[model samples]
Target: MGLALFELPAVSYEGNLKEITDQLVILVLDDGRTFNFKRSTNTKFFKNSKALKAAELKPGDRVALVAKLDDRAFLVASTVTFVEMTAERSAEIAAGVRRAQETADAASPVRGWDGPQLKRRALDEPGPIPDPRAGQSPSDDPLIAKAQDAALSFSEALPNFLCEERMQRFSRDSRMIGWKPLDTISAEVIYEDGRESYRNLKINDRPTNKKMEELSGSWSTGEFNTTLRNLFHPASAAVFQSAEYSRLLDLPARVYDFEVRQENSHWNIQVDFQKITPGYKGSVWIEPASGRVLRMEMQAVDLPPEFPMDQVETAVDYAFLPIGAAAVLLPVHAENLGCQRGTDYCNRNVIDFRNYRKYVSDSTVKFDP
Candidate 1:
C-alpha cells in the first residue's frame, strides 16, 4: 500500500512491537499509528543492554528504535531496543512520541522536499539533520546558481569519448540477507555531441547482436547529461533547498535536497510494456566552494499500489577522469535498486564506467588476414 509521507525528528521512537516477520518488524505507537520497519543484519537488537536476535522480539514488548524513512516510504531500523513496559514508562514514551510529532509538524511547512534528511548516525557521533533554507527561490539561492551553472556546462565541457560500461546484476529476496549474482553485461558506450549510444553488447563476455536496452533485466541510460538537465534545466522546474553538510570522496560537500514534480519529470519507468513518469525527490552533493556535483541520489515517489514495482532508487557517483588529453568530470559508479510490489524480492544493478579514451573518427586498425 502507498504510504503518506511522515516527518519525524532524529530521535528514537518508542512503541510496542506489533508484528514481526522475517523481513520487517511492525511497531504500534501509543497513538495507535503503526510503522513498518525493514530490518537488516546491521540492525542492532537489544534488551536491557544485552544483544538479542530479531526472532526473540515478541508482540506486546515495549521497544524503542532509531529509524529513518527511505525513498520507499518505509522505515529502516538502525537500532531496536526493547524496554521494560511499565505503566509509568509507557506513559513517558507516549508523551515523547507526541512531542516529536509536534516538532516535526511545525517544521513540515519549511521542509521543501519530501525525502530522507538525516544522515546515518555513527557510533560515537550524532547524525546531521537537515537545515532547510526557508523562503528562498532557486534564483535567490547562491548555491542553486552554482549547481545550475555547473550542470549547464556539463555537456559543453566534455569532449567526444568512448567508454566501456560494466554492469553487474544482483537480486535478493526481501526476507534474505545478501545479494546473489545474476549476470554481468558489458557494452561499448559512445558519447558524441552530448548524446550517448551503445554498441557491442555482451553478456558475461559473450557477444550478442541484441541492443543493450533490449536485454531482459533492469537497465538505465542518460547518466551522462540527462540527469543534470532534469535538475538544472528550466523546463524541469525542480525545487531545491539546503539539506545538510556531508562528505563525498573524503571531500566536504554541501548537500541540497531537490524534487521534480511528476508533471515536469522526464524520468520514465517501464514495467512489462507499461511506462510511467513518476515524481522524484533526491539529494545532490556538491563541492562547497566550486558547486561541482560530486554525487546524486534519486527516488520515485507517490506510485500507485497497483503498479508492479513499489520502489525505485538510484545513486550516481562522479569523478574526474582523463579523456582525450583532458580531465573531465564523469560518472564513475552508479547503483540502481528496484523492488517488486506484492513480493519479497528486489533487483540491483551496479554499473561501472571505465576504459575511457578520446574518440577519433580517422583512427584505423590493421590486422593480418
Candidate 2:
C-alpha cells in the first residue's frame, strides 16, 4: 500500500465562556468538553459583528472560536466571534456576525510561556507556611485531637448521598508545552453503605456507548469515594509525619502529611506511586475549630528507575453540599495528574461533584425500551 498525506483538520469547540483567569479562557462547550485556550495578541476577538476585545467576552456569552495547535503545543484561538441580538431584537444574531475577528494587541501573558497555561493557580502554589513549627509532636498539640475528632465525626456522619460528577482527562500535548483535553466524562456518583457506584451518564456531551472504553467511568471510579471516607479514619495503616499549620477555604487548619507504602507489589489499576518511592505521600487539612477535613493532596514518592511515570499529583477539595434538606461535607472536586518521564506526556483527571440529592433507593435496572 502507498502512503498518502492530507492536511490535519484543526480542533474547535462551541460553548459558553465558563471562566477567564489570568492567562486562560475556559469554555464549557455544548459537546461536553471544557476546552482551555490560550489567548495571545494573535488571538482575535469580536462582538455584535464588530471587532471587540477579549475582555469584552463575558461568561454566558454565546461564542465560537476557530483554534489551532500552536508551535508551543497549546490550543490558540485564531479567531473569536461573538453572537448577539440587537439590544431589542428577539432573534439570534445574523449569521454574518460569526465571521467577525479582531486582533487583541493589549492582552498580557501571565506565565513565562508565550500563551495561557492550564496549570491551576490554587493547585500548584502551596501558599505560605503557617506558624513555623520545625520540631513539634502531636502528643502535646491540642489542635491534633480537635482535628482528629473532627475527621472522625465527619466520617461517621457521612450519609448516603448522590451528586453529579464531571471528570475531564488531559494528556500532554504531543508537540506543545502543556496538556490538552483528551476526554470528558460526566457521571452520577452515589455512596451508601460504604459502597460507591458511578453511572456513566454522558461522554463528550453524548450518550455513553458501551463500545467506547475511554468514555466509561469504570476506569476512574472507586478511588476517590473510598479514599475520602478512609483517609482520616483513625484505623488506617498510613502513618502521619510532620504537623504544621495551613489554611483551606480561607479558614485556619492543622495539616498532617502522611505516607502509605505497599509491602511487595507493584501498582495495578493506576500508576503505583509507592512502587518507586517508599510509599504514597499526602497531607490532610482539617478545620481548626469545627474539626472537618477540608482538603487533601497526594503525590507519588521516590519514583524508581525505568518507572513509567515521573510524577503523580492529586488533590480533592471538600465543601458541604446539600443532599435533600441536609448539608454534609462532601468531595466537590478531585484531580489526578500523572506525568511521564523524559517526555511531554501527562495524564490528568479532573472530577467535579455537583447536584447532590439524598439517596432514595439502591435498586437499578436497564433495558431497551
Candidate 3:
C-alpha cells in the first residue's frame, strides 16, 4: 500500500527546542507550529550520543523528524537524521574546479588577431563539397559557405554581448507572506576560477508595490544556485541581441564582422562590439561537430558606474559522446569564479527564498546541438 503523506517522515524541519522537562522535548517550528517529543533511545542513527542529549539541540540546525499528531499538538517519536545544506556541496565543487581552471589559464598563452584580413581570407576560401541535381549555389545552401559566414559572424560578436541581471533579497520570515515566490525570479550568473558573479535577470509579469520595501544587495555563497540558473538559461542569447540594453555593455547593434579559431574540438569565435563604448572582448566555444555553445567568456570595461566593475572569469565543462547521428553535450561539471569580497557581510544577508518555479522554453535547444 502507498504511504500517506502524514505517515511518511518529514526530512527536515528548521526549529528550536522550546521546553525540555523530564524525558520530553518541545520544538517550535518556524511557522509557529509546535510539537512535543522524546528522542528514541533505541535508535543508532545519530553518530554522536550528545546529539540526543536534551541540552544539545539548537534552534537553527535542520532535523529530520518523525512524529504522530495528537489532539491539539504533535508527539515526536524519532529523530531520523540531520539535513545538509545545499551550500556545502556547492562550495566543495566550486573549490575543485577553480583550481583546475587556474592551472589551465596560466599554461595557455594569449594570442592576437587581425580581424579584417582574416575575414577576407575566409570569404575567398572554397565552399563545401557539392551535391548533384540540387542546382543550389554554394552560397544559397543553408549549410554552405554563406552559412559558415553567418555562423562566424555570430561567434565573433559573442564577446561584446552584455547581459543585465537583477537579484531580490528577502528575510527568513518573508516566507510566511507567500507573496513573492522564489521560483519566479530568473537570474543569469557565472562562476569560474573561484569567483561568482551575476550576468542578467528576467523579472516581469509579477506585481510590485511602491509601499513594499525592496531588498537589494549582493548574495551569499549559500545562494549560489540562484546565480547558476541564470547563466545556463538559453534566453540569454536573445538578451545579448537586444538593441537597447546591448549598448549598455558596449556591443554593436548589429554584427558585420567575425573570425573563428580552433581550440581542441571547439571553435572559438572572436566578435567585435565596436559601436558599444569600451567594446566587449569575449569568445564563444562551440562544438564543431554539433554547433552547440559549450561555453562562453566575455570581458568589458566602461560599465555604468552603479554596476559592479570587477573582473569576471567563468567556464562550463561539457562531455561529448556520439549518440546516433549527433554528439551530445553532457554537463559533466561546472566551476564558478571565486569571490573578491569576503563572505562575512554575505552571511548576515542570507535570505530564505521559497516557492521556486522554473521557466523553460517550449522549443528548448539541446546542449549538444
> Once model 2 is optimally superposed onto the true structure by TM-score, how far is the C-alpha of residue 45 displaced, in angstroms?
67
> Per model, how many backbone clashes are there?
0, 3, 21
Overall lDDT per candidate, in order of appearance: 0.75, 0.60, 0.31
Worst 10 residues of 2 by lDDT: 96-105
lDDT of 1 by residue, 1-369 (tens): 998976664446777897777678777656434566787677889988999988898898889889866666556788999887678976787677677656544542221223222222131123355556645675688878888888988888889888888899988774435788999988878888888988778888888999976788899898888887677888888988776766767667777788999778888776543356778998888886777788888888765444567678888888878986787888999888887764557788999988787877643222111
Lowest lDDT 10-residue stretch of candidate 1: 115-124
Global lDDT for candidate 1? Answer: 0.75
Q: Give the top-scoring candidate (lDDT).
A: 1
How do these models rank on TM-score, best leading?
Answer: 1, 2, 3
TM-score of each: 0.63, 0.55, 0.21
Which prediction has the highest TM-score against the true structure? 1
* Per-residue lDDT over 1-369 for candidate 3, one digit per residue giving the tens place of the 0 to 100 score: 997655544334444455555566555443224455654454222423335554544655555555543444334455534445578855764565566446544543221211101011122123222334244332243332332343334323222111112333322222133223232233333333323343233334243432112222323231222222332233222122201111101221111111121111121111110011222334333333333443333333222221222222233333443433443332333322211121111111212222221212221211110
lDDT of 2: 0.60
Minimal lDDT window, size 10, model 3: 267-276
C-alpha lDDT of residue 313 in model 1: 84
